[model samples]
Target: MARKPTSPADEVLLAAARARSSTVTATQLERWRGAGLLPRNVTRSLGRGRGSTSAPADGVVDLVVWLAQHARPGRRPHDLALHAFGEGLAVPEPTVRAAWRASVQRVVLSGERDLPAPADGEDRTDWAWDVAERAAANAASVVLPRRMRRIDERLAAAGVSWAPSELTQYDRGPAGEEPVTARDFATFAAAGVLAGAPELTGPAMAPHVRALLPVGAVSPVASWLEYPDEPGRDPAEINDGAGLSLLPIGDVREDLLRVIDEAEPHQLRAAWRAAAEMREWALEHCGAVEAELDAGELGDATLAWMMGAILGLPRLLVRQALLDRRPSISTQVSTAVMVLWIGVSLHRLRRLMPDGQYELLPALLPPFLHPLAGIPLKPVGEAAADDAVG
Candidate 1:
């Protein structure tokens, strides 16, 4: 059913929407237009000092119907934008960027927000030091999800191994060369990714990555991750050089927002793919671990995979993602950007290696995740040149 030009545009859209589902209303169209979930009709003036006439663009009625279907009380416009993006709906670019901004702010620490304004003529170094202190304290923000902890306890009882002993012996976290607990190391690593803490780029976090991988055979990605921090070496010669630091002092959120705001549609799609793959990896590993627990024995590989997927890369991605804990589409889309950030970082670290030194393994490498996210991996320089062109 289509509306004739004789009908009012809002009425046409509302009727089309209501035709699909009677719940849609004229007021709903107005509200969604205000929120950017729906676009207003286009208008053109009559030639002879007459008022303009208007009509909704083609297919807006369907979009209106889709928006209404997703609508609910308490849903934010950002949520609608993200959901629209995920579904390939015609949600506006500005709304999607706004959604990305909200997602970035979610993990920002309270200290970053509440810093006292610099006292008149006080050294800016004081503010710098304050930032460094709060950032170092970022590791304290790590929390083993309650459900994951419970699963670990269950597995520990079932003769499945918990966090590897190597984790305790590994040099890890802000405390240099000191052994840290598995959860401690993983927690710090999670924090470090966002904080640009140097400890993460060093040998410290390699063991955690090793423990997290699901591969049953020799994993190649670990070799690069465990690459030594050479003394007095050229900056390009080590992982510390190309590590995940973002400019403007590694405010990843700012860079990530820029990426989203500026990325081409295909790039965004690729990022989404990578995030989905990682999430699947986490789910499959946990499922295997749970199955083993049911059968009364956990595979060593499965245990390691479980820890890596949930604790290693998920970072701020929380909860079991089941029932009430299920993430909203908006949250899911936002978190994908976080994974894209990590994937791009992995790509950067890979560039530190001499050509052919490391193999590309989409199944194992965090860098290849870009391919999963929808980016084709080419030579680093070529990829850079292509991105510049795009």
Candidate 2:
């Protein structure tokens, strides 16, 4: 049977979907469009007083057909955007923006823009401590999440205890001098800045470079940031070598919201790719560590993984989320934004160096991060091959 010339666009899409063996319906199409997951159709007028003809826009039929085929019962519009963007499909721009924005909205920071000045006859140092205490209130608590503690228990059961080393203090952290960790310092620094205290920047720098690069490389790279020295440090020495530009100069949260909201389609797609890559690398690296532990072997892998326990991906994810269910794509996208921010900041630090010939830095990292750093990770395969040779 021939269809009418002016059939509704949704019906046309449905027909295309049916051809592809998809279970799409008019209602589903309407809902997807409302959620910004699907693009709207185009309408054109016929000549000589004829009625108008409406049809799905270019690539719409194919996308709709895909949506019909792959749609999960509880899958969200943001998830669809992430999948579509990942697959190189032309997802609607608004959908990508809104979904990414929503992803970052989950993280919350509480503080006032202006802190009350020290009262008359108040000790200035006491006032600073009071302010710092309030800022530290939100710092990541020392009590490990249940999942992380379970992993720690497993490591302990295996007689795998980390030596108290300067390179990786996370195993027995909260170093005696300051209760402020890199993260707590960050919170205080941010609040202090907003409250008109730029001096906090020197001490508040986050050691994100160490997470991205090895300690040896991190030292030189940190110097490249041109970070101002703290009181006890030499002027040439950047306090912990973390640069101040990792985040923009305004409200960090608001800046992130704007960045996601205003990002172009290609930009969003790039972040999606990074997000997917980050997840893959994390899973692969963590799985490799677990495999080694199960096989009763101890080596560099365990050392690196344990050192990164708190600063790396959430323990809830490694021990719980994967077993429970996958994270929503929107959340993955949000995480990617943060990763990129660190990466770009690292690159910016490098650009500050006088002689930038350290291209081998990625290859120099701990084995776990090698894959993500673009070093082709094949230690497992190599080990198997070595056994064969032996």
Candidate 3:
């Protein structure tokens, strides 16, 4: 039998759902709704005993599409909820955090039970669990505050205003462009961002690196040199030496190139692991901040911390993972990739500000030893003195 033709209302609803991305499907939508990552559709009565039809809630389709892009098997539901919140969904903050906390408790309990019987002279399994518990507790206590503080310091130094409303809407640059570089990664690691194993790399390094480049700009050199076009500029005309030099990652190109040239197969695997972990952590942190913002509890202090986390955490994780141990071929390559990832993310955040805002806020500049290397160097002491006199 032939199926009945769809109504115009149904067609409009389907089109609205697909506006963000063309790949959404009924199964994915249902799954997300079941998981509570999306809201239920609104239905109208058809009269008699006939079934009702509904349209997907406003923004729910976009939210579902975004969540699908980041979904992985074995990922916890709370984590998904948090991710949705971080991506600016209207999900309630308390609900997501409550879910996350409960999930964490379950994992902790399962981890305790799953411990294998220790061999002779191996009483450290229990000790390891204890340490893990303590670390989890510490992370819970400090992660949010620490992130907010870091952001605050950076913004203060940069002289950016801290109104919560403005901060929430603060641009993170072009959606596709994220700055990643080796030098920033090295610096972040030295500063102890995520503080994990020297031997292990985050899992998402390769994908992150690939995401930073334009299509066909996959070669190491091309990815490093190519700049995404700025508003009002031609893409082909945007890569002048001076413009390139102005980027923090630009200074680290040689270092990043060398690391990529020397990576071994096993080391690459480790790098991949490290990169994935860093990206995950970043998204998780972003979600937490966004949740708090939604709750109307994001004070200046907290907002600052979040800004810091966004700016610093990726580099910290990547750098520490790469430099924690002796440099091997895999670690080197992983480090190079991770650096690019961090650099790209950082560049994107910097670009999020209106063009002149970045320049006006000096603290937003990359943390370079010779900060003036790319941009014209101004004497801070003179500027301060002038301000004092004024």
Candidate 4:
């Protein structure tokens, strides 16, 4: 036989009424529950292994009951009551918790009445908005101009709807390239298309592009950016623009001597593809960098970054190479990170390339010359001084 349907009051109000001696009406119980003073689930279990069944103290239920009993109590400050509720429960649902918490807080914080001191000030909704605005502005400020359409499309494809002001704020920057927003960056990240974007293409680009997402692979462009080079130009001095120079500084028209300084040259075509592969490898396996840089592993510490750069360099080549066709086992994954591990470390110690030479110059060379452009592969002392030089 079918049992009669439980009354609406019985469904929600019965438990509260039973817990409170059934003195309060079901409606009243519901009102308290809606007000968030009542615990959603109250499990009643008999005491175990005892002579008499005594009402046991439940820490969780006691806290809940205490919170509701004092909630919005007459003569109590609104803010005080509100904070009390939060302190009582460890709730996970943010929206529900926040709404109820707000209601209790508002009552405690009402104008002109004093209560117990609050742990923290909570009245600044605008502060949150201000932070969001500034963050969007910073993101927009860095977007590359050439990538405007791509950024727009990526945002759209991701089904992200942003206000014009928000987009403008996020993309706001100098006239050239508009920097990608963090949100948009995350979107491109999810789609796995960050590596294929136009701004990340070519032999040279900014360091942040590679740094944005934790890609499975690195690009040749990234390799070129980190390339080490020959005489008078140290690798660090190239990308960061700081180095002592020995050339004659001058103007061509005048008879005056000119010391023209340049970024350390890295051979792009040759090193980029290989370096990218290493970059991808390192990223994929978190310990790849540490392993390559290990004193015992890849013992010649000078070769670390340069070799690591080779690992990811292929990623750059593959992106362009695969544009026309698909690669079955494209090394465009994290395995390339290893190459960059070697590349960056060696570059750091300024041991990967010929001293006094510009790293950036070699990076500008064609990819076909990759095998030949770099300094000799032999260890520092083993290779002839003149032959070891790039």
Q: What is the TM-score of each candidate against the true structure?
A: 0.63, 0.58, 0.27, 0.19
Count of clashes, each model? 4, 0, 35, 99
The residue pairs in collision within model 1 are 212-308, 270-373, 270-374, 274-373
Q: Which 10-residue span in candidate 4 carries the lowest summed lDDT?
A: 253-262
lDDT of 4 at 65: 48
Cα lDDT, all candidates: 0.56, 0.54, 0.42, 0.33
Please, what are the lDDT tens digits per residue for candidate 4 over residues 250-345?
111011101001111232122335544433433333233335434334423223322332334433332233232333212221112223223333
Which residue runs of candidate 3 sit more than 4 Å off their true CA positions? 1-13, 43-55, 92-95, 103-390
- Runs in model 4 deviating more than 4 A are 1-179, 182-285, 288-327, 330-356, 359-372, 379-390
After the best TM-score superposition of candidate 3, give how far the Cα of residue 272 lies from its true spot, in angstroms: 26
The root-mean-square deviation over C-alpha atoms between each candidate and the true structure, in angstroms, is: 8.9, 8.4, 23.5, 27.0
Error of 4 at 285 (Å): 7.8
Top-scoring candidate (lDDT): 1
* lDDT comparison, 1 vs 3, better candidate: 1
lDDT of 3 by residue, 80-192 (tens): 76556544565434445354334323333222355532453245434443434433432322212344344335444444443335433432222244554433233232212
